[model samples]
Target chain A: AQSVTQPDIHITVSEGASLELRCNYSYGATPYLFWYVQSPGQGLQLLLKYFSGDTLVQGIKGFEAEFKRSQSSFNLRKPSVHWSDAAEYFCAVGPLMDSSYKLIFGSGTRLLVRP
Target chain B: DAGVTQSPTHLIKTRGQQVTLRCSPKSGHDTVSWYQQALGQGPQFIFQYYEEEERQRGNFPDRFSGHQFPNYSSELNVNALLLGDSALYLCASSLWGQTSLDTQYFGPGTRLTVL
Candidate 1:
């Protein structure tokens, strides 16, 4: 079955530090990948998505993810971490079927930014 | 344009009760999907509706149902609510048939608590 795995349940980094969140997916065919961030008591916000073309995809809030087909991974990265960036990040893989996009999401990674 | 919106920001229901959550898609979006986000977990797809019909569903039981209207607004209904059924219900909208690659925009989500 198709599934997304976010190995890290939580990661802590100092403010202004670089951030990297790992994600791996298992799917039979090439799939659309996405990264979303959610704050406490808030809905998810789309950070980035990967379809065809360039592997490096940039999203809002200076977040970017690289799609590595060989590794079946799409990892999110940020050059500088801010306190406001302390939120839960999720990785999702979607496949189009019957004119619908059904997404399978990973458990999520919670980021804690330290001062 | 207005973003995806959900009604009843929070609701409390007792066991065996039923509850309904509403969603209005973002402007120009024609597809609506529902998801359940348990605390500390990622959002899981419940179902997707397009053209006023259910196109695809997740592994949820029949107790979970949904409907979509012509204006692209939708509702999620849950029957026989269990304590475990309490979660944040998220509504996402996108233009499915218009493009092969679509990004789902999420609403603020409805928090349902079962007592």
Candidate 2:
């Protein structure tokens, strides 16, 4: 079965510190990967996506993710953590089964920024 | 454009009742997709509509149905709702694409609380 795995349910980082959130996926073919961020009581916003070509994709709000095909991983990264950046992050994979546009998402990781 | 828009930000329904949620696709988007986001989990795809037809669907039961109008707006109807049906319902819009690589923009989502 195709699915996404976010091992960390929650992570905390101090303001101004670097942060990384791990994501792994299981799929048969080359998967379309995406990262989304959701603030409390808000809708999800697309952070970035990896379809083909470049493995390192830069997103809004100074966020970026590197897709490593060998490990089936697409980890999101930020050079400096900000208080406003604390939110829930979701990793999703789009499998090309029957040309369906459905997205299989991970359980999600909640980020907490400390002062 | 105005981006995707969903109506009735919050709703309450009882078991065995029926409910309908509406969505308006972003300004130039031609496809609309529905998703169910349970507490503490990522969103799960329900279905997608394009050109007033059901294009693709996820693993949802028949109890969940949808309709798209000529104007490219859509509605999702759930029959015989269960307590487990209580979740955040999200609506996303995208341009018609042959693959899942198309970028989907999301709405604020409707919070459904079933009793």
Using DockQ as the measure, the top candidate is 1
CA lDDT of each prediction against the hidden true structure = 0.92, 0.93
**Model 1: lDDT of residue B22:** 100
C-alpha root-mean-square deviation, candidate 1 = 1.2
Supply DockQ values for each candidate: 0.66, 0.60
For candidate 1, what is the TM-score? 0.96
Judged by DockQ cut-offs, is candidate 1 incorrect, acceptable, medium or high? medium
Candidate 1 per-residue C-alpha lDDT over A44-68 given as tens digits, one digit per residue, 9 for 90 to 100 = 8989888789999999999999999
Q: What is the Å distance of residue A99 in model 2 from its true position?
A: 6.8
**Stretches of candidate 1 exceeding 4 Å from the true structure:** B99-102
* Steric collisions counted per model: 0, 0
Model 2 lDDT, residue B95, Cα: 82
lDDT of 1 by residue, B1-115 (tens): 9999999999999999999999999999999999999988899999999899998899999999999999989999999999999999999998987445566789999999999
